[model samples]
Target: MCPLFSNLFEIMIPKLDPTVIYEIVVIVFLACWFIATVLCQFRETKISWFIRYKIDLFNLIPLWTFFAPHPGKRDYHLLFRDKITETDYSEWQEMEITEERTFWSWLWNPEKRDKKILSDVVQSLVSSIPSFREKTGNLNLLMFSTPYIIVLHAVSQCKKRSQNCYRQFMLAESSGYQKETKPALILLSVFHQI
Candidate 1:
């Protein structure tokens, strides 16, 4: 025998029991379920499509992308500039979105509502861009979309509301956690009067 198996005979190996077989069966079942779930994650994949549409009658297999599908790997930056006039424009200013976390936030968090609302609004708007383009076949007409209108109106309502001033907001993406990455423009809105 090889040196690795020299002690194999010396160690008493227990015979397979009913409990051991049951444990193995459970483990194998779990493993298969995990594999099927992963394979059925993305609808674009041929396997995923077939699995979802063909054999799944009662829809047992969970088509989940684990916990977070598109996790927040980057920071969202909503920057706005005031167009004081047709000829004059103010410097871009960052909209304060993030709030400092407190230990008591877990028990009593009221201020988080505004942050959550802003985040959800932005998320919906960002997600609708591609769908809007495909539906209308014109990017310029995207201004009519509900999400765009909401953000535009919300921004227009913020800070120093007056007839003389106009506001333009842009959504930029960056990795605040990553020092090397730079901010990239995601969406820019037309100037709207306050």
Candidate 2:
């Protein structure tokens, strides 16, 4: 070992034998690996407010795929919409989102059942936009589809007045689309182009 490393080790592990040094190195390596793995997992799974904001921002990029509703069993709208659609969660007990897997086979994977639910809800929302427009006409509606408070603040900053729009938007703040009508209209237009 270099004198500098030897000196550092001498101070850090003063009483260490060769066997102890080896064990110490192994333990530190394992600890670093464990911490890195945990951070990776957190980055992958932890959906933070920043991530939600990013999702909302991407939602406005005029990309139809971004609006592509989740094709799963759970309707995210149920928690925010006027009425919840009753669907059998068991139907999605096997649904998985594997890249190589066939659609039919993925429908049986319980691990992905929740994803299926979220997808289905988004699909339903996309489908319902046309119906809403048909009933309400092309009003200057501020619809908030996301369930984030920050998204609401962003919407308030982005949209102009129509107190009615704000009330309607706030009514479903926790669950479904806030300014969903416009987004739905946007989705409809995109869907037609596709």
Top of the candidates by lDDT: 1
Maximum-TM-score candidate: 1
lDDT of 2: 0.38
Off by over 4 Å in 2: 1-108, 139-142, 145-194
The residue-by-residue lDDT of candidate 2 on 87-171, one tens digit each, is 3111101112322335676466554555454444445445656666787795223144442233234233433333333211211
Pairs that clash in candidate 1: none
Q: Residue 87, candidate 1: how far off, in angstroms?
A: 2.7
TM-score, predicted candidate 1 vs. hidden true structure: 0.59
Global lDDT of each model? 0.76, 0.38
Clashes of each: 0, 23
Candidate 1 lDDT (Cα, 0 to 1): 0.76
| Over 4 Å off, model 1 | 1-67
